[model samples]
Target: MDYIGHIKLVNGQVPSESLLLDEANIAASRRVDLHVQTHDDPVLKLCLWDQAASEFWKKFRASGGTARVVLVTTLNPKRYGVLSLSSMTPSRVFLDGDIQETRDYLGWLSLNQDVANRLNADVVVKPEPATLGELFSYMKRASAKVAWFECTAAIDNVVHGSKWYYIGCGDCHPKATKGPTTLLCRKCGKSEVVGVAQYLAKLSVYDHNDQAFFVLLGDAGEELTGKKAAELVESYYEANDGVGDDDIVPVPQVLIDTIGQTRTFIVKISTHNLDGKTQTLTVTKVLPLEAPAPKVKSGDEVDVELCNEREDLADESVKRAADGVGSEDAKRARCG
Candidate 1:
């Protein structure tokens, strides 16, 4: 069967052909694993060898890792525990074409940040506690040192600047060109791709004295929405059945329900100016109000001084009342 899809990755250095006969074929085969996501739903892995391998490897290296190609090749579907596809003779390939499927896949690749995140999952430790006001103030201060801040505040409202979800390029996952036959990623300058659904939830949250805009991206957005953007998009299509791809997916009710709710979050504040000012907050983690936090010891100097000051004032007030009562009693005895 002719398998046509995007080349998501091109691995390095082909091993000798003899490695193909050994069990090491799993590791050798000098195989190039092409992560291909279809325009509709499923993402598949395709392996290339021989001429196909040499051509793809050459172009991939030439493009500085941004090269995308569509392959129309006969594939051997093998089931070594899992179903896999490998290139066979009589295969063909296309690069950066005007084909609609190629265009759709490219669009998807450019905006597929979730796909990128899954491909590159690295743990980021949550930051220290702060207020929304403090987060903004930190960004403004010339000597600000912290990179991330943990904050608790009431979500004043969910800002509907446009739609809650955005159609982004699968490759770089940035917002893509709309109303065009092919998706275009401005950053990568690639076209003919599909759009991936991702959350772009902007929230207005505030403490007692101040309010700031906080953005929840990808998993953080999914956490706030209580469902993945892909899941929500799929559900919308299942319900609407024949809706056009250009039609917008409605905001999930779960996301809507977050309004006026209080949640603790770890956010990274942007220090550099964007658009005009530098104070921007991005939520990295959504935690429950009762989430475990480090205990502040009562013996800390600040706490100790506050306790001492309250106790001293209490003692002085009691002594003044006692003296007033004794003087009144002495005056009453003198009068008698």
Candidate 2:
């Protein structure tokens, strides 16, 4: 057995109402014995027997004395009150709560196995109905053997190899909502679709911090001839003596279907100094093509009928290609 020392109650040691006064006195009296007789190593085993147990343990641990402190208290509501008040210190506080009822504390300790194993002192707890289940769940997972003295029948569920006794509750659980309304979970990457509108609203707000905005539209006729359209817009701007910069305004939304496919964009051009007014310009011509065609030999005159038929074939080919189904075999096998 790991020397179970009891801080029993005694009379006249201090004021009658002072909780843990007897335990404190016993601890004080045994300080010298613990230093000199405990193999000169100064490790005295101390336990609590009073309401002031939490305070006494905190002071004893903080005093840098020669004793190793252990708290053995029932997991009653009163014990929880005391432990919760003194919980900020690093020392272990145990509860004599029912092992089955105090499973949550056990679960916490079991989850933090490495920290629990290295603890130098005992922290006891009194288990409630909820705690018993939590503790059993925890014990099922813990790898170390938790030893205890004065085992009671109420907590027979604690097996031989259990390590964590209940300490106390740290915090309460948060409330649940009717449904998830957020797009992303900060904890996980899960996404929800219902909050898309809210997310977009948040993004559009001035303080939203997102700067980029884009509109993806179906293919536009103007887009097919981007270079030609751009040059045409530039010439129009120059001819109109609009603002000097080459800032082309986007085409009106209504014209997107007509101009997008032609690679031609429409923009409204205006200058702030010019009465804050703007005019739309359609840029339809691009840089002139160089070497428009290959010269044919004068003697190698192609037949007129052949030339006309070739032009018709070429136009038909272009139409078929635009329809997204142009095969060489189909063209060869068909007559326009």
What C-alpha lDDT values do all the predictions have? 0.56, 0.24
Off by over 4 Å in 2: 1-55, 64-68, 71-172, 176-336
How many backbone overlaps does candidate 1 show? 25
Model 1, span 30-110: residue lDDT tens: 556665644433545566776666565555545555555465567787532124577876665555444666666667767
Writing each residue's lDDT as its tens digit, candidate 2 over 1-336 gives 222122212221111233333446655643211110111122222333333444544444453322222243332211211111122223334321323323444454445546433323222222222122222332344331221111111100111111111111112111111235533332223343222100000000011122110111111112322323234444546666755533433332222322211111211111210221111111111112133344565788643322100111112222222222211111011111
Q: Residue 272 deviation, candidate 2, in Å? A: 74
Error of 2 at 176 (Å): 5.9
Off by over 4 Å in 1: 1-121, 178-180, 186-190, 241-248, 271-280, 288-336
